[model samples]
Target: MAFDSQWGLSATGFYVPSYEEVLDSIQDDFIARFGSDIVLTSNSNFGIITRMMARREKASWEEQQLTYYSAFISTAIGTSLDYIGGNLGLKRKVDEPAFATITIATEGEYLIQAGEQFATESGYVFTLLKDVVTTQNNDGSWSGMGMVQCEETGADTNVPINSITTEVDPDENILSVTNFEKAGGGQDYEDDETYRERLRMENEARPGSTAAGIRSALMNLPGVREVNIVQNPSNATDKYGNPPYSVHIYCLGGDKGSIAETIADYIAAGITLVGSQQLKVKDATGNKLDINFDFATNKPVFAKVVINTDDAWNVDNGAEDVKQSIADYINELEMGDPVYITRLYPAIYDIEGVTDASIAIGTSTTTLQEKNMIQTDFEAVTCDPDDIEVVVNGL
Candidate 1:
């Protein structure tokens, strides 16, 4: 019987004939065909020439060619796959900055001119875009002219306020201002592979897309990470100003104000607003602001992990790893998603010493629903290292 296919251990990989073996075979063939008198040994000139020919054949065919073939399959294939995805439209998401309004209080009726700068104690600079002049109304109540649009200088503009604190300007006449609301819109630039995936989503969109279409578009914006577009959420209250046939978008990432305004504007452009269905809003001072919606507070939840390990071990170190694993799992949870206590079990069991784990999360010993129609870029429910408790049982 003869073998038509290439001989190999497995797949296309094959073992090549060595130079010494081929040389010996060639000598045996020559001796068998010629007579026993024609002896081809190592000292013979013909034997030397045969060995040299064998070496050349082995170097070219077995060493060089086979090595190249193996590498071409193992290494370049990954790059080729990436090239294919690039052709299919995959790209990374970019970063965005946060915006805030800082009030510049005056000792007297001072005019906080536009472009006036205020700095936090830690030197976070906030600047005003337009002049905010002090004004008195007929009702003896004052409004506007105090709040100023402020952006962080340079790259680091994102910061959260413990409470609404008034910041003091570097110079006099400017009191303290704190960004009561959490600052958002800070994100790292997406890498090549991540960008590619985003592009694929857009390419796959149809002429008339579904909720995923809106999500894809919103995710493309800088600083947006997670998006959940629930259409006609009539089962719940008409919260977040969502009317019948309306969509309740729960976004995680980006500046709350920016994302809120962007969502309202995008919908308003394509749809008509009539009757009492107005998107217009006014501030306390009767300044007509665009749209009607607001960001909600981040709901806090706690997690306790009880693991039954076979024996006692370095639980303190193990606990840190367990906490990080749980945090990563929670971070990936979608906006408005109910907390799954069982989800933490897998994360805790992944730790080396944990044989089994019983995890409890939130205030009660059950799954908790997410609130806040719009969770800003940094407002997702997170478990601080302190928030997670890890106990090893069966010691």
Candidate 2:
């Protein structure tokens, strides 16, 4: 009877979809775009979890975008969860990327000396070739004066050579090799060969034959770490081309300022013997004479100084100390640091007491201490009452 009453009302039934059908509808679309290797699940939530797990596994194995994105999302979720659970990871990574630095070191005085030597050599060579004087008379006769000019027998070019086997003697006025050569060329052909040989012999007898001697002289100076020298034959047409030379000095590690100053001082003290013009020999009564002399001058020569650190950026823990020492050295030498140089890192790092909590707590403590000191009797002096009372009683 009751079943008949229930049947009189509207009939109702439950509809349950198949797991395979639902999974095929949703997961098939996902797999078409993503891949067929993806796993299908009965539950939507379970399908999502499976997809995430698959992506994470793939990402872990093959550093692909899908895997990377999944891992990043997982990490974000995991980190959030861990933070909520109060489990922070070990240490935060420093933001600075890795890099390397270079530094140079040299002495200023050494650089100056090298430069001066270069200049002196340049001048000597220039003067030797350029300062020639020729006198032409009305009879169409040409006479050359100054250093002796010798004619090359084979080359037909004028060569200058000193005649004296020793230094130029004050009493003797022997013809210059250049003059002898020219005279011999005009007088007899046999004399030309003799003069040419004499010029070659004189050149061979020069004090320093090779550029190595000049480089050695530079190296002998203080604070010179490395030295390089170069020499080339000057063009015969150019004034200084007759005897050309070049020098370069490389100082690896030293006080550049001090070195530069020392070089300048040495130059000022006239340690280098340079050419200058002087009056010819004269009698006691001051009679005019035909001789000329090479003298020394006090004029300061031009030089260039370059100072640098050997390796600036690779200092150890003691870098600051070393850098300070370098700075002090520079100051002592009276030179400023180069503009390109800068502090690679902070002079000091607060690693001793730096913690997330300590920093916050220390800030609060400092504020409180500062506030309390504002109204304190900082200027008031206190006397002991017992000591005062004893003093009064004794009085």
Candidate 3:
């Protein structure tokens, strides 16, 4: 009886049902009566129901049409979010922007020879030669003075005025001077203390000074944007409160591999360390550039890593796979022993598709519903190269 009332509609004389009738039909409908409004409603009611049904059907059809669409979208978004969550990846993308910062760590001894002494109004000239020597043009009033000088020492008073001299041998005490002045003719114009101090200052200011040498050495490498010398106060002071000297280099441009190689070559060429140690370049997040040098042995060690991943349709799944692959690859790398995970990232892609089929009496053919799942690739990496091992286990 309830089904009869729910399925049956009171005949409204106007050919189609009213808004009220449709509502009543939905509330009362039992099975077959549910769709009765398709034929019973007035034009306006019929049109409204038809449009609403069409939209609802479209959404439902879309869901069934593609199995992987949602999966792919979700994976991409989720993986990217995870990557950004790590600080190193964020800073690298933001601060480094277009270039990568690389650090070269090395240690070696330099062979230096102190040059001839000369007299000038400002002071005495004592030229020091080291490595394959090349001289730069002298600017200002001090120009064309082949040698740098300091105040004459008493020991040099009896020596010949124009005598050209050469200094001590190679690999000697690091802090000792290679040459010294014997007693000379003029009023002991150069004081050894004053001479040494002036030379220190001049070498620091000269373009061929230790700082300049390091800069020049690095600039010779390809893609080096610029170089800066920074002093580290923490290590700058000695136990006796004397000022310790150090060189901090700022390097930009080039990928990690090229930069590391250039640095190794420079170390092998004999750049001396001002103090007992040196500092390397680091990112904003304090991630150190890949570089190593053995000062004791005068040998430089370098590490290089390359990562590649398969295409991924899902971010979460793809990132996992990439993380695992990177870990596995790193384990197989010989040079990557000192390497640690530094950062990870997710690259995402979007895909879409649809299918429709129909049949008519004239065609006399049956239509089958069609559906498919789209495919895509996702990529990600671990921060520490060594962490790749851990990622493999987790993946």
* Per-prediction backbone clash count: 17, 20, 42
Q: What is the lDDT of candidate 3?
A: 0.31
Better of 2 and 3 by TM-score: 3
Could you give me the TM-score of model 3 versus the true structure?
0.18
Tens digits of per-residue lDDT, candidate 3, 326-350, equal 4443323221122232311221111
Candidate 2 lDDT over 153-254, as tens digits, reads 211121122221121221122222122211111111222223233223333432132444333332333322233322233433224222333222232222
lDDT of each: 0.55, 0.25, 0.31
Candidate 1 ranges with C-alpha deviation above 4 Å: 1-91, 94-96, 111-172, 188-200, 206-210, 230-248, 256-297, 306-316, 356-358, 363-380, 391-395
Candidate 2 — which residues are off by over 4 angstroms? 1-213, 221-325, 328-339, 342-395
lDDT top scorer: 1
True-structure RMSD, every candidate: 10.0, 34.2, 28.5
Ranking the candidates on lDDT from highest down gives: 1, 3, 2
Which residue segments of model 3 deviate by more than 4 Å? 1-44, 56-395
For candidate 1, report its TM-score: 0.56
In the range 84-177, model 1's lDDT, one tens digit per residue, is 4456443344454455655434454556667765555555556666777655556654333333333543224555663335344455554444
Q: Could you tell me the lDDT of residue 261 within candidate 2?
A: 31
